[model samples]
Target: MEVLIRPDADDAARTVAGIVHQALAEGVRTLGLATGSAPVGVYRELARRHRHEGLGFAGVDAFLLDEYVGLPPAHPQSLAEVIRRELAEHVDLDPARLHLPSGTAPDLFAEARRFERCLTEAGPLGLQILGIGVNGHIGFNEPGSSLASRTRLKTLTDDTRRDNARFFGSIDDVPRHVITQGLATIGEASHLVLIATGPHKARAVAAAVEGPLTATCPASVLQLHPHATVVVDELAASRLEQQAYYRCIARHKPARHRY
Candidate 1:
Protein backbone atom coordinates (compact mmCIF):
# COMPACT_ATOMS: atom_id res chain seq x y z
CA MET A 1 0.00 0.00 0.00
CA GLU A 2 1.12 3.58 -0.71
CA VAL A 3 1.17 5.72 2.40
CA LEU A 4 0.96 9.50 1.93
CA ILE A 5 1.32 11.71 4.98
CA ARG A 6 -0.07 15.13 4.23
CA PRO A 7 0.47 18.25 6.30
CA ASP A 8 -3.14 18.43 7.42
CA ALA A 9 -6.62 17.07 6.88
CA ASP A 10 -7.39 19.46 4.05
CA ASP A 11 -4.22 18.48 2.21
CA ALA A 12 -5.04 14.81 2.67
CA ALA A 13 -8.52 15.38 1.32
CA ARG A 14 -7.15 17.18 -1.73
CA THR A 15 -4.80 14.30 -2.47
CA VAL A 16 -7.72 11.85 -2.37
CA ALA A 17 -9.92 14.16 -4.41
CA GLY A 18 -7.16 14.39 -6.99
CA ILE A 19 -7.17 10.63 -7.38
CA VAL A 20 -10.94 10.60 -7.88
CA HIS A 21 -10.76 13.52 -10.30
CA GLN A 22 -8.02 11.75 -12.26
CA ALA A 23 -10.13 8.56 -12.37
CA LEU A 24 -13.15 10.47 -13.65
CA ALA A 25 -10.99 12.18 -16.22
CA GLU A 26 -9.83 8.76 -17.34
CA GLY A 27 -13.45 7.73 -17.97
CA VAL A 28 -14.04 5.64 -14.89
CA ARG A 29 -17.79 5.57 -14.29
CA THR A 30 -18.34 3.58 -11.14
CA LEU A 31 -17.25 4.61 -7.62
CA GLY A 32 -17.48 3.20 -4.11
CA LEU A 33 -18.12 5.99 -1.61
CA ALA A 34 -17.74 6.10 2.16
CA THR A 35 -19.59 8.49 4.47
CA GLY A 36 -18.02 10.07 7.57
CA SER A 37 -16.09 13.09 8.77
CA ALA A 38 -12.99 11.59 7.21
CA PRO A 39 -14.37 11.79 3.66
CA VAL A 40 -16.41 14.98 4.08
CA GLY A 41 -13.51 17.18 3.04
CA VAL A 42 -12.80 15.12 -0.05
CA TYR A 43 -16.44 15.42 -1.06
CA ARG A 44 -16.37 19.16 -0.57
CA GLU A 45 -13.19 19.46 -2.59
CA LEU A 46 -14.77 17.48 -5.41
CA ALA A 47 -17.83 19.67 -5.22
CA ARG A 48 -15.64 22.77 -5.51
CA ARG A 49 -13.98 21.37 -8.62
CA HIS A 50 -17.36 20.61 -10.14
CA ARG A 51 -18.55 24.16 -9.55
CA HIS A 52 -15.41 26.11 -10.46
CA GLU A 53 -13.26 23.80 -12.55
CA GLY A 54 -16.07 22.28 -14.61
CA LEU A 55 -15.28 18.83 -13.32
CA GLY A 56 -18.30 16.69 -14.12
CA PHE A 57 -19.90 13.45 -12.95
CA ALA A 58 -22.69 13.36 -15.49
CA GLY A 59 -22.82 9.59 -16.05
CA VAL A 60 -21.03 8.43 -12.96
CA ASP A 61 -22.60 5.83 -10.70
CA ALA A 62 -21.69 5.63 -7.01
CA PHE A 63 -22.26 2.82 -4.50
CA LEU A 64 -22.19 3.70 -0.82
CA LEU A 65 -20.22 1.55 1.64
CA ASP A 66 -22.98 0.87 4.20
CA GLU A 67 -26.10 2.07 5.99
CA TYR A 68 -27.65 1.72 9.42
CA VAL A 69 -30.15 -1.15 9.65
CA GLY A 70 -32.99 0.53 11.51
CA LEU A 71 -32.77 4.19 10.59
CA PRO A 72 -35.55 5.61 8.42
CA PRO A 73 -34.53 6.36 4.83
CA ALA A 74 -34.86 10.07 5.48
CA HIS A 75 -33.04 10.03 8.79
CA PRO A 76 -30.41 12.75 8.75
CA GLN A 77 -27.85 10.39 10.23
CA SER A 78 -28.43 7.67 7.63
CA LEU A 79 -25.43 7.07 5.39
CA ALA A 80 -27.52 7.68 2.29
CA GLU A 81 -28.74 11.01 3.59
CA VAL A 82 -25.24 11.88 4.73
CA ILE A 83 -23.86 11.29 1.24
CA ARG A 84 -26.67 13.29 -0.30
CA ARG A 85 -26.01 16.22 1.98
CA GLU A 86 -22.23 16.16 1.69
CA LEU A 87 -21.58 15.22 -1.95
CA ALA A 88 -24.53 14.66 -4.27
CA GLU A 89 -26.35 17.87 -3.51
CA HIS A 90 -23.31 19.90 -4.53
CA VAL A 91 -22.65 18.23 -7.86
CA ASP A 92 -24.42 16.97 -10.98
CA LEU A 93 -24.50 13.37 -9.72
CA ASP A 94 -27.98 12.02 -10.30
CA PRO A 95 -29.78 10.82 -7.19
CA ALA A 96 -30.96 7.71 -9.03
CA ARG A 97 -27.38 6.70 -9.77
CA LEU A 98 -26.22 6.85 -6.15
CA HIS A 99 -26.95 3.27 -5.02
CA LEU A 100 -27.08 2.34 -1.34
CA PRO A 101 -28.04 -0.91 0.36
CA SER A 102 -31.60 -0.81 1.65
CA GLY A 103 -31.46 -0.38 5.40
CA THR A 104 -35.14 -0.84 6.06
CA ALA A 105 -35.85 -3.84 3.86
CA PRO A 106 -38.24 -6.27 5.49
CA ASP A 107 -36.05 -9.18 4.37
CA LEU A 108 -32.60 -7.79 5.03
CA PHE A 109 -30.82 -10.98 3.96
CA ALA A 110 -32.49 -10.77 0.60
CA GLU A 111 -31.61 -7.12 0.43
CA ALA A 112 -27.98 -7.97 0.99
CA ARG A 113 -28.08 -10.48 -1.85
CA ARG A 114 -29.85 -7.99 -4.09
CA PHE A 115 -27.41 -5.19 -3.30
CA GLU A 116 -24.43 -7.45 -3.90
CA ARG A 117 -25.97 -8.41 -7.22
CA CYS A 118 -26.49 -4.76 -8.03
CA LEU A 119 -22.84 -4.03 -7.30
CA THR A 120 -21.74 -6.92 -9.49
CA GLU A 121 -23.97 -5.78 -12.33
CA ALA A 122 -22.66 -2.25 -12.16
CA GLY A 123 -19.25 -3.66 -13.00
CA PRO A 124 -16.07 -3.37 -10.94
CA LEU A 125 -15.65 -0.08 -9.14
CA GLY A 126 -12.83 2.02 -10.54
CA LEU A 127 -12.22 3.46 -7.10
CA GLN A 128 -13.38 2.73 -3.55
CA ILE A 129 -13.13 5.39 -0.85
CA LEU A 130 -12.77 4.29 2.77
CA GLY A 131 -12.60 5.67 6.31
CA ILE A 132 -11.03 3.73 9.17
CA GLY A 133 -12.90 3.64 12.44
CA VAL A 134 -11.07 4.05 15.74
CA ASN A 135 -11.27 0.29 16.24
CA GLY A 136 -9.79 -0.26 12.77
CA HIS A 137 -13.07 -1.28 11.13
CA ILE A 138 -13.91 -0.54 7.51
CA GLY A 139 -17.50 0.03 6.48
CA PHE A 140 -19.31 -1.77 9.31
CA ASN A 141 -17.15 -4.87 9.16
CA GLU A 142 -16.12 -4.74 12.80
CA PRO A 143 -13.35 -6.58 14.56
CA GLY A 144 -13.63 -10.37 14.18
CA SER A 145 -15.42 -10.06 10.82
CA SER A 146 -14.29 -12.73 8.39
CA LEU A 147 -11.57 -11.41 6.10
CA ALA A 148 -13.26 -13.12 3.16
CA SER A 149 -16.78 -12.05 4.09
CA ARG A 150 -19.22 -10.66 1.57
CA THR A 151 -21.98 -8.07 1.73
CA ARG A 152 -24.09 -8.86 4.79
CA LEU A 153 -25.72 -7.71 7.97
CA LYS A 154 -23.42 -6.96 10.90
CA THR A 155 -24.01 -5.99 14.49
CA LEU A 156 -22.39 -2.73 15.54
CA THR A 157 -19.78 -2.97 18.26
CA ASP A 158 -20.00 -0.72 21.31
CA ASP A 159 -16.94 1.25 20.27
CA THR A 160 -18.39 1.88 16.82
CA ARG A 161 -21.77 2.85 18.28
CA ARG A 162 -20.14 5.31 20.63
CA ASP A 163 -18.06 6.80 17.83
CA ASN A 164 -21.13 7.31 15.68
CA ALA A 165 -23.35 8.49 18.52
CA ARG A 166 -22.10 12.00 18.00
CA PHE A 167 -24.09 12.11 14.78
CA PHE A 168 -27.31 11.37 16.62
CA GLY A 169 -28.98 13.14 19.53
CA SER A 170 -27.86 10.46 22.01
CA ILE A 171 -26.06 7.14 22.21
CA ASP A 172 -29.42 5.44 22.73
CA ASP A 173 -30.53 6.64 19.32
CA VAL A 174 -27.69 4.88 17.51
CA PRO A 175 -28.67 1.84 15.49
CA ARG A 176 -27.54 -1.55 16.69
CA HIS A 177 -26.79 -2.99 13.25
CA VAL A 178 -25.67 -2.10 9.73
CA ILE A 179 -25.42 -3.66 6.28
CA THR A 180 -21.87 -3.27 5.05
CA GLN A 181 -19.63 -4.28 2.21
CA GLY A 182 -17.25 -6.86 3.54
CA LEU A 183 -13.47 -6.93 3.22
CA ALA A 184 -13.55 -9.33 0.29
CA THR A 185 -16.17 -7.25 -1.46
CA ILE A 186 -14.23 -4.02 -0.90
CA GLY A 187 -11.06 -5.64 -2.19
CA GLU A 188 -12.64 -5.98 -5.63
CA ALA A 189 -12.23 -2.32 -6.44
CA SER A 190 -9.49 -1.49 -8.95
CA HIS A 191 -8.19 1.24 -6.66
CA LEU A 192 -8.74 1.71 -2.95
CA VAL A 193 -8.14 5.11 -1.33
CA LEU A 194 -8.50 5.34 2.44
CA ILE A 195 -8.46 8.82 4.01
CA ALA A 196 -7.76 9.34 7.70
CA THR A 197 -6.98 12.34 9.90
CA GLY A 198 -6.85 13.66 13.48
CA PRO A 199 -4.86 12.33 16.43
CA HIS A 200 -7.66 9.93 17.44
CA LYS A 201 -7.04 7.91 14.27
CA ALA A 202 -3.28 7.61 14.76
CA ARG A 203 -3.22 4.15 16.28
CA ALA A 204 -5.83 2.71 13.94
CA VAL A 205 -3.90 4.06 10.96
CA ALA A 206 -0.72 2.49 12.27
CA ALA A 207 -2.41 -0.88 12.76
CA ALA A 208 -3.93 -0.78 9.31
CA VAL A 209 -0.75 0.39 7.56
CA GLU A 210 1.87 -1.64 9.41
CA GLY A 211 0.25 -4.15 11.76
CA PRO A 212 -0.40 -7.81 11.00
CA LEU A 213 -3.12 -8.72 8.53
CA THR A 214 -5.63 -10.15 10.94
CA ALA A 215 -9.40 -9.97 11.20
CA THR A 216 -8.95 -8.05 14.44
CA CYS A 217 -8.18 -4.99 12.34
CA PRO A 218 -10.38 -5.20 9.28
CA ALA A 219 -8.75 -2.16 7.66
CA SER A 220 -5.47 -4.03 7.72
CA VAL A 221 -6.85 -6.01 4.77
CA LEU A 222 -5.84 -3.04 2.63
CA GLN A 223 -2.29 -4.21 3.02
CA LEU A 224 -3.09 -7.12 0.70
CA HIS A 225 -4.56 -5.00 -2.07
CA PRO A 226 -2.29 -4.49 -5.07
CA HIS A 227 -3.37 -0.92 -5.53
CA ALA A 228 -4.28 0.63 -2.22
CA THR A 229 -3.40 4.17 -1.10
CA VAL A 230 -3.56 5.39 2.47
CA VAL A 231 -3.68 9.19 2.66
CA VAL A 232 -3.36 10.49 6.18
CA ASP A 233 -2.67 13.74 7.95
CA GLU A 234 0.38 14.08 10.18
CA LEU A 235 -1.65 13.37 13.29
CA ALA A 236 -3.01 10.15 11.84
CA ALA A 237 0.44 9.07 10.67
CA SER A 238 1.94 9.76 14.08
CA ARG A 239 1.85 6.14 15.14
CA LEU A 240 3.16 4.60 11.92
CA GLU A 241 6.57 3.02 12.58
CA GLN A 242 7.99 3.68 9.11
CA GLN A 243 6.93 7.28 8.68
CA ALA A 244 10.31 8.30 7.26
CA TYR A 245 10.32 5.52 4.68
CA TYR A 246 6.75 6.28 3.66
CA ARG A 247 7.61 9.91 3.19
CA CYS A 248 10.66 9.00 1.12
CA ILE A 249 8.54 6.76 -1.11
CA ALA A 250 6.00 9.53 -1.60
CA ARG A 251 8.71 12.05 -2.37
CA HIS A 252 10.24 9.94 -5.11
CA LYS A 253 7.03 8.62 -6.68
CA PRO A 254 7.35 8.28 -10.44
CA ALA A 255 5.83 11.07 -12.49
CA ARG A 256 3.44 8.65 -14.20
CA HIS A 257 2.06 7.66 -10.76
CA ARG A 258 2.10 11.09 -9.14
CA TYR A 259 -1.59 11.09 -8.21
Candidate 2:
Protein backbone atom coordinates (compact mmCIF):
# COMPACT_ATOMS: atom_id res chain seq x y z
CA MET A 1 0.00 0.00 0.00
CA GLU A 2 1.18 3.51 -0.88
CA VAL A 3 -0.21 6.65 0.71
CA LEU A 4 0.27 10.17 -0.67
CA ILE A 5 -0.62 13.18 1.40
CA ARG A 6 -1.28 16.52 -0.22
CA PRO A 7 -1.96 19.94 1.23
CA ASP A 8 -5.57 20.01 0.06
CA ALA A 9 -8.18 18.34 -2.12
CA ASP A 10 -7.23 20.11 -5.36
CA ASP A 11 -3.61 19.04 -5.04
CA ALA A 12 -4.65 15.45 -4.34
CA ALA A 13 -6.90 15.56 -7.40
CA ARG A 14 -4.06 16.81 -9.55
CA THR A 15 -1.80 14.04 -8.32
CA VAL A 16 -4.44 11.39 -9.04
CA ALA A 17 -5.28 12.88 -12.44
CA GLY A 18 -1.60 12.75 -13.33
CA ILE A 19 -1.53 9.06 -12.48
CA VAL A 20 -4.68 8.38 -14.53
CA HIS A 21 -3.27 10.29 -17.49
CA GLN A 22 -0.08 8.28 -17.27
CA ALA A 23 -2.08 5.04 -17.12
CA LEU A 24 -3.92 5.98 -20.30
CA ALA A 25 -0.64 6.91 -21.99
CA GLU A 26 0.60 3.44 -21.14
CA GLY A 27 -2.41 1.97 -23.04
CA VAL A 28 -4.68 1.12 -20.15
CA ARG A 29 -8.20 0.73 -21.56
CA THR A 30 -10.44 -0.65 -18.84
CA LEU A 31 -11.18 1.61 -15.89
CA GLY A 32 -13.28 1.21 -12.75
CA LEU A 33 -14.92 4.53 -11.92
CA ALA A 34 -16.43 5.99 -8.74
CA THR A 35 -18.78 8.86 -7.85
CA GLY A 36 -19.39 11.30 -4.93
CA SER A 37 -17.91 14.62 -3.73
CA ALA A 38 -14.52 13.11 -2.92
CA PRO A 39 -13.72 12.38 -6.57
CA VAL A 40 -15.46 15.37 -8.18
CA GLY A 41 -12.23 17.35 -8.20
CA VAL A 42 -10.38 14.54 -9.93
CA TYR A 43 -13.11 14.32 -12.59
CA ARG A 44 -13.05 18.08 -13.01
CA GLU A 45 -9.30 17.97 -13.51
CA LEU A 46 -9.61 15.18 -16.06
CA ALA A 47 -12.41 17.04 -17.86
CA ARG A 48 -10.22 20.12 -18.03
CA ARG A 49 -7.45 18.08 -19.60
CA HIS A 50 -9.92 16.66 -22.11
CA ARG A 51 -11.14 20.15 -23.04
CA HIS A 52 -7.80 21.96 -23.20
CA GLU A 53 -4.95 19.44 -23.36
CA GLY A 54 -6.55 16.98 -25.81
CA LEU A 55 -6.49 14.15 -23.27
CA GLY A 56 -9.10 11.72 -24.54
CA PHE A 57 -11.10 8.87 -23.02
CA ALA A 58 -12.52 7.74 -26.38
CA GLY A 59 -10.60 4.46 -26.25
CA VAL A 60 -11.43 3.61 -22.66
CA ASP A 61 -14.16 1.37 -21.25
CA ALA A 62 -15.44 2.19 -17.74
CA PHE A 63 -17.33 0.12 -15.15
CA LEU A 64 -19.12 1.82 -12.30
CA LEU A 65 -18.46 0.49 -8.80
CA ASP A 66 -22.11 0.32 -7.62
CA GLU A 67 -25.65 1.66 -7.84
CA TYR A 68 -28.65 2.31 -5.61
CA VAL A 69 -31.00 -0.70 -5.91
CA GLY A 70 -34.44 0.93 -6.20
CA LEU A 71 -33.63 4.23 -7.86
CA PRO A 72 -34.89 4.79 -11.39
CA PRO A 73 -32.16 5.20 -14.00
CA ALA A 74 -33.53 8.61 -14.82
CA HIS A 75 -33.67 9.77 -11.24
CA PRO A 76 -31.51 12.82 -10.60
CA GLN A 77 -29.80 11.23 -7.60
CA SER A 78 -29.26 7.88 -9.26
CA LEU A 79 -25.61 6.81 -9.50
CA ALA A 80 -25.93 6.45 -13.29
CA GLU A 81 -27.20 9.99 -13.68
CA VAL A 82 -24.58 11.28 -11.25
CA ILE A 83 -21.79 9.70 -13.27
CA ARG A 84 -23.20 11.13 -16.51
CA ARG A 85 -23.53 14.62 -15.06
CA GLU A 86 -20.17 14.45 -13.28
CA LEU A 87 -17.77 12.60 -15.55
CA ALA A 88 -19.01 10.62 -18.59
CA GLU A 89 -20.84 13.45 -20.36
CA HIS A 90 -17.86 15.74 -19.79
CA VAL A 91 -15.38 13.36 -21.41
CA ASP A 92 -14.90 12.09 -24.95
CA LEU A 93 -15.52 8.48 -23.94
CA ASP A 94 -18.19 6.60 -25.88
CA PRO A 95 -21.49 6.38 -24.02
CA ALA A 96 -21.84 2.72 -24.96
CA ARG A 97 -18.52 1.92 -23.28
CA LEU A 98 -19.76 2.97 -19.84
CA HIS A 99 -21.04 -0.11 -18.01
CA LEU A 100 -23.39 -0.05 -15.02
CA PRO A 101 -24.94 -2.89 -12.99
CA SER A 102 -28.74 -2.99 -13.32
CA GLY A 103 -29.93 -1.98 -9.88
CA THR A 104 -33.55 -1.85 -10.97
CA ALA A 105 -33.81 -5.28 -12.59
CA PRO A 106 -36.88 -7.38 -11.68
CA ASP A 107 -34.53 -10.18 -10.61
CA LEU A 108 -31.87 -8.17 -8.85
CA PHE A 109 -29.89 -11.15 -7.59
CA ALA A 110 -29.68 -12.63 -11.07
CA GLU A 111 -28.68 -9.23 -12.42
CA ALA A 112 -25.81 -9.12 -9.94
CA ARG A 113 -24.63 -12.57 -10.98
CA ARG A 114 -24.78 -11.55 -14.63
CA PHE A 115 -22.79 -8.43 -13.90
CA GLU A 116 -20.14 -10.42 -12.03
CA ARG A 117 -19.85 -12.94 -14.85
CA CYS A 118 -19.48 -10.18 -17.40
CA LEU A 119 -16.80 -8.50 -15.29
CA THR A 120 -14.81 -11.73 -14.92
CA GLU A 121 -15.00 -12.43 -18.67
CA ALA A 122 -13.69 -8.95 -19.35
CA GLY A 123 -10.73 -9.74 -17.07
CA PRO A 124 -9.03 -7.55 -14.49
CA LEU A 125 -9.65 -3.81 -14.58
CA GLY A 126 -6.56 -1.76 -15.44
CA LEU A 127 -7.33 0.76 -12.75
CA GLN A 128 -10.08 0.96 -10.15
CA ILE A 129 -10.88 4.37 -8.70
CA LEU A 130 -12.47 4.50 -5.23
CA GLY A 131 -13.89 6.96 -2.70
CA ILE A 132 -13.83 6.04 0.97
CA GLY A 133 -17.00 6.72 2.92
CA VAL A 134 -16.81 8.44 6.28
CA ASN A 135 -17.86 5.18 7.92
CA GLY A 136 -15.04 3.16 6.34
CA HIS A 137 -17.33 1.66 3.67
CA ILE A 138 -16.20 1.16 0.09
CA GLY A 139 -18.70 0.70 -2.75
CA PHE A 140 -21.44 -0.08 -0.21
CA ASN A 141 -19.65 -3.13 1.12
CA GLU A 142 -20.48 -2.12 4.64
CA PRO A 143 -19.26 -3.35 7.97
CA GLY A 144 -19.56 -7.15 8.40
CA SER A 145 -19.35 -7.70 4.62
CA SER A 146 -17.37 -10.81 3.81
CA LEU A 147 -13.85 -10.21 2.54
CA ALA A 148 -14.33 -12.80 -0.21
CA SER A 149 -17.83 -11.72 -1.22
CA ARG A 150 -18.78 -11.11 -4.85
CA THR A 151 -21.01 -8.60 -6.57
CA ARG A 152 -24.48 -8.64 -4.98
CA LEU A 153 -27.36 -6.71 -3.48
CA LYS A 154 -26.51 -5.34 -0.02
CA THR A 155 -28.59 -3.76 2.70
CA LEU A 156 -27.66 -0.20 3.62
CA THR A 157 -26.85 0.55 7.24
CA ASP A 158 -28.61 3.40 8.99
CA ASP A 159 -25.37 5.32 9.19
CA THR A 160 -24.85 4.99 5.46
CA ARG A 161 -28.46 5.98 4.79
CA ARG A 162 -28.10 9.08 6.92
CA ASP A 163 -24.85 10.02 5.23
CA ASN A 164 -26.48 9.75 1.80
CA ALA A 165 -29.76 11.41 2.75
CA ARG A 166 -28.58 14.83 1.61
CA PHE A 167 -28.20 13.56 -1.94
CA PHE A 168 -31.74 12.14 -2.00
CA GLY A 169 -33.34 15.22 -0.39
CA SER A 170 -34.38 13.29 2.73
CA ILE A 171 -33.43 10.20 4.72
CA ASP A 172 -36.76 8.65 3.78
CA ASP A 173 -35.95 9.03 0.10
CA VAL A 174 -32.68 7.07 0.34
CA PRO A 175 -32.74 3.55 -1.02
CA ARG A 176 -32.59 0.73 1.51
CA HIS A 177 -30.44 -1.45 -0.72
CA VAL A 178 -27.68 -1.27 -3.34
CA ILE A 179 -25.78 -3.43 -5.81
CA THR A 180 -22.03 -3.26 -5.16
CA GLN A 181 -18.86 -5.03 -6.06
CA GLY A 182 -17.50 -6.93 -3.07
CA LEU A 183 -13.99 -6.68 -1.61
CA ALA A 184 -12.90 -9.81 -3.45
CA THR A 185 -14.16 -8.41 -6.73
CA ILE A 186 -12.44 -5.08 -6.13
CA GLY A 187 -9.22 -6.87 -5.17
CA GLU A 188 -9.04 -8.34 -8.68
CA ALA A 189 -8.20 -4.98 -10.16
CA SER A 190 -4.62 -4.42 -11.31
CA HIS A 191 -4.54 -1.12 -9.51
CA LEU A 192 -6.70 0.58 -6.88
CA VAL A 193 -6.57 4.35 -6.30
CA LEU A 194 -8.65 5.72 -3.42
CA ILE A 195 -9.08 9.47 -3.03
CA ALA A 196 -10.37 11.14 0.11
CA THR A 197 -10.56 14.68 1.49
CA GLY A 198 -11.81 16.73 4.48
CA PRO A 199 -11.23 16.14 8.18
CA HIS A 200 -14.52 14.27 8.45
CA LYS A 201 -12.87 11.25 6.82
CA ALA A 202 -9.70 11.24 8.96
CA ARG A 203 -10.62 8.52 11.43
CA ALA A 204 -11.98 6.22 8.79
CA VAL A 205 -8.88 6.80 6.66
CA ALA A 206 -6.68 5.91 9.61
CA ALA A 207 -8.70 2.79 10.34
CA ALA A 208 -8.49 1.70 6.72
CA VAL A 209 -4.80 2.35 6.14
CA GLU A 210 -3.21 1.73 9.52
CA GLY A 211 -5.58 -0.54 11.38
CA PRO A 212 -5.88 -4.33 11.17
CA LEU A 213 -7.32 -5.93 8.04
CA THR A 214 -10.87 -6.69 9.09
CA ALA A 215 -14.32 -6.68 7.52
CA THR A 216 -15.45 -4.24 10.21
CA CYS A 217 -13.68 -1.62 8.13
CA PRO A 218 -14.31 -2.70 4.59
CA ALA A 219 -11.73 -0.30 3.16
CA SER A 220 -9.06 -2.18 5.11
CA VAL A 221 -9.07 -4.68 2.26
CA LEU A 222 -6.91 -2.23 0.36
CA GLN A 223 -4.07 -3.27 2.61
CA LEU A 224 -4.30 -6.72 1.06
CA HIS A 225 -4.15 -5.44 -2.53
CA PRO A 226 -0.89 -5.92 -4.38
CA HIS A 227 -1.06 -2.47 -5.88
CA ALA A 228 -3.10 -0.01 -3.85
CA THR A 229 -2.75 3.76 -3.52
CA VAL A 230 -4.41 6.08 -1.07
CA VAL A 231 -4.44 9.80 -1.88
CA VAL A 232 -5.74 12.16 0.76
CA ASP A 233 -5.51 15.75 1.85
CA GLU A 234 -3.74 16.69 5.07
CA LEU A 235 -7.02 17.03 6.92
CA ALA A 236 -8.08 13.53 5.97
CA ALA A 237 -4.66 12.15 6.82
CA SER A 238 -4.74 13.67 10.28
CA ARG A 239 -5.29 10.49 12.26
CA LEU A 240 -2.68 8.51 10.35
CA GLU A 241 0.16 7.77 12.79
CA GLN A 242 2.64 7.30 10.00
CA GLN A 243 1.81 10.52 8.19
CA ALA A 244 5.41 11.71 8.06
CA TYR A 245 6.62 8.31 6.87
CA TYR A 246 4.02 8.22 4.14
CA ARG A 247 4.92 11.71 3.03
CA CYS A 248 8.62 10.87 2.91
CA ILE A 249 8.00 7.70 0.95
CA ALA A 250 5.83 9.50 -1.58
CA ARG A 251 8.43 12.16 -2.01
CA HIS A 252 11.22 9.64 -2.57
CA LYS A 253 9.32 7.25 -4.85
CA PRO A 254 10.80 6.95 -8.34
CA ALA A 255 9.17 9.07 -11.03
CA ARG A 256 8.71 5.93 -13.15
CA HIS A 257 6.33 4.61 -10.49
CA ARG A 258 2.84 6.03 -10.93
CA TYR A 259 0.98 6.63 -7.60
- Predicted structure with the largest TM-score when compared to the true one: 1
User: What C-alpha lDDT values do all the predictions have?
Assistant: 0.94, 0.91
Query: Against the true structure, what is each candidate's TM-score?
Result: 0.98, 0.98
Q: Which regions of candidate 1 deviate over 4 angstroms?
A: none
- Steric clash pairs (candidate 2): none
User: For residues 57-165, could you state the per-residue lDDT of candidate 2 as single tens digits?
Assistant: 9879899999998888889988988888888989998999999998789999999998898789879999998999888999999999999999999999999999889
Per-residue lDDT for 1-259 in model 1, tens only?
Answer: 9999999999999999999999999999999999989899999999999999999999999999999998777999999999999999999998899999989999999999889999889878999999999999999999999999999999999999899989997889999989999889999999999999999999999999999999999999999999999999999999999999999998899986786
RMSD of each: 0.8, 1.0
**Cα RMSD for candidate 1?**
0.8
Clashes (backbone N, CA, C under 3 Å), per candidate, total: 0, 0
